[model samples]
Target: MKRKYIVGLHILFWTLLITNNVINSIAATRAHNTVIDSAVIFKDIMLVAGYNSIMILCFYGSYFLVSPALFLRKNYLKALLMTAVLLFLMTGWRYLLEFWFFKPVLGFDNYKGNNVSVSYYVSNIFWYYFPKYFVYGLLYFSAENWIRNRNRQEALQREKLSTELAFLRSQINPHFLFNTINDIYSLTYQKSDEAPVALLKLSKILRYMLYEGARDKVPLHHEVEYLNDLVELQRIGSKGLANISFEIEGYVGGQEVAPLLFVAFVENAFKHGVLNDPDKPVCIQLKASNQQVEFSVSNSTVVSGTQKDQTSGIGLSNIKRRLELIYPGKHELIISEQERYSVYLKIQLGS
Candidate 1:
């Protein structure tokens, strides 16, 4: 798409340039002959078309012909030297063909009569044709500049995305650690015999975080194991009757997904849903198939006059941006809040 847009822009620019030059040529002839019209303009454009053909031919062909050798030699100076030589030859040929062949064929009246000399030809040829080469050179330089800036912009975007992703990943690991440590602290304070079991579960989660989750993507099985471990921590923290339920309905198969993609949803549920009150409970369902994965977390929260303080929504927002970058049109996210808050996210892999 980008390349097509650039090409379209270049074509538009050259079309305008050629149209302007045609108008100027006809206007110049009209100044002296007083017999210019659309026919004259068309004729002048046709006369220049022969040289323009050479300009385009050399512009595209000669560069490609020498580019391989230039790259092989790994010498920029030599490559530039070759380019200069090719330009000179092409310019000289264009000048020769236009003056010696095209001018006479078009019945152009030279102010100096039929006789042509080095000085006369040079004055006529250089003045008339040099500007065409200047136009070509300008076009080349502008195109190169456009390409350079485009590459620089793409590089910056990639680096920015990488940095943001790393920061998001960093936040995720520590967030999970904070929650796990809180659970461990509760277990220790209560002097519960399940402290050893909680420690073991923490160790497993930490091992996955250290090894598997650090990667760009992790196996489906590994992520499920981590999710189960997280649910176990929630159960332990809930003291066996917290009314929190997590269910996975479908097989994940052997597919891989981006690490920690499910963490934000789970964390939000645990943070807001796991209340000490027996009247309210959290319901979370996660399901995956070959084509899609869906997560739904809904919880009951009462409307109150007190201010509901929430931290920066960066974690969930980062997940949103990652979905945009990685899945784009293949994902859907719906967030609804009322007496009950719910988040539904579905990603279509096969789409």
Candidate 2:
């Protein structure tokens, strides 16, 4: 993808190709093959190199111009026509180079005293050289398109995932603030001592969502702090009735994670989870060790009739796409849904 590397590879490929041509040139000069003079042999190799150089024009013209600008752009007819025009010019130029320089240097007198003719041009271009150059152009065009298409697909996939991540913020609806205010209002009339703690938790959650959670990376401890505050906020609203448990195990001292990466899973669990169930409560667990992190969240599902999240698939899909983009081969996600919906995620942390 880097320009230097692309150039280096081009140099390397052409170097090998020219080296092979030189070796073959030497082999063709063997006495058993022909008793040609050294100067004539040299002239022949120059002819070969001249023709090869013109073929490279075909290579570049098709790869850079015709293929991308026309072929891959879906102008199939135009691409073919342009390729034919380029081949005519390139092969004709190579013919001129041969007739004027290489043929005279080798003492070939077929066109002596400028007696060049249409029959000779047709014989060399149409019968001898056109097929070889056409195949060369096709090879370069096909190879270039193949590689470029693959790169474009991967880039588009990443772009789509990034757009999904940015869109995910919309899912964090405004209802939380409205409900929290009402909960505070009720608590204030009763003079409940938990109201102030709830407000503090609310402030922490908002501050992280607006500031730290919007950053590219946050200290792992900061994410854990946010998670703790989020769980506490949910518990406060439930008034000791939701039965949510949160725990952290192993070392989490010097790591950093993508901001808000795990928030969707927790939020989905609370939004779709059956909070009033006594036997099946929401459980969230996280562990970090040996340069790896594991997180698992499971919650009971409400009955189909009462479950409100009938069209809430985008959040889970968003997390899956984010995991693919950010962690790539370094993470795995497992989802299970029968009675209780559960998600298990394992990621190798970047230092």
Candidate 3:
């Protein structure tokens, strides 16, 4: 993944701000003294620097540690009381340090020796420290809110994409089923003997598609079961109607595959091959392993007439789009023809 540029920039900005302020303070200290090196200036402010660093980090750390638990437990009143007490204690601590140690050592006795009114100290504390603390607190809460909103938006977008893909897959499956059922309806009307066997096979295919195939994924064993049912349906229906053969090779353990992903090519074979002529043969071969599945279907077609017939076809196009969406760069598909036309697909399931 690429680095987060904004986070790096934020760290860099804070470093520069801290360094610039420290250097400026040291320069001011050096202006009035003869022993005005970086070392002397650091020694003069060392105690102040140490105390400020510890106090500032302590305040920020404590606020973050408590705020989430306080909000989650719905203890706003307790949180507010604790915060107020902390601020009061911090104010007293700063005053004590200034009066007892810093004033004597740093020559800040003008503010301490003169009985500066209570109002003077109160104003200095409120104006100088309150805004700084409030702004830091505000930024912390704002970042949390921004992160939550971005997550929510991303979730909504994923749900939308999933819905659209499901609809597209639905369109392909239903169209194939409806056409085959209509063909069965015509055969049953003529009192054909193969009608009962065809109906039983169709019921099995429908049951699997409506139940198992509706899921996000199904076991490879279930996919093989559905394919067997589909081929049986085609075989029985095409006995005197057309010549067709379906084949499968290789072991498929308990791996999973997206439902109806391989069915489109099967449906296309019948559409383009079965109705053309009883003399013409349609052949489909499937080879599967733990890591890959290879499927190929071949059918002869009259190019001009078939092209016109395919104008409203959604089977092949829908399958291609669904593969792109689900597998992305993990799958390959090639469709072409020689003296014998064919559709070939190879998919690699992630390990």
lDDT of each: 0.65, 0.71, 0.64
Q: Estimate each model's TM-score.
A: 0.51, 0.54, 0.47
- Model 1 pairs whose backbones collide: none
lDDT of 1 by residue, 248-336 (tens): 88887676676667766666766666456567677778799887888887778632212222442345766676676556567998877
Q: Of the pair 1 and 3, which is ahead by lDDT?
A: 1
Better of 2 and 3 by TM-score: 2
Q: After superposition, how far is residue 32 of candidate 1 from its true place, in Å?
A: 20
Residue 165 error, candidate 2, Å: 9.9
Residues forming the 10-long window of minimal summed lDDT in candidate 1:
303-312
In model 3, what is the error at residue 348, expressed in angstroms? Answer: 1.3
lDDT of 3 by residue, 1-351 (tens): 124875587568656755666677777776877677655665546544544543464346335644543543457776676566655665666666667766666555535566766567656655666567544654665576567557655654574466445544443345556666876887799898777877887887767766775576788878877777776666555545557666878987677777777766666666666443656678878788888888888888623222322422444665676676566567888877666667788888763
What is the Cα-based lDDT of residue 4 in candidate 2? 100
Off by over 4 Å in 1: 1-193, 274-280, 302-314
TM-score of 1: 0.51
Q: Which order, best to worst by TM-score?
A: 2, 1, 3
Could you give me the TM-score of model 3 versus the true structure? 0.47
Better of 1 and 2 by TM-score: 2
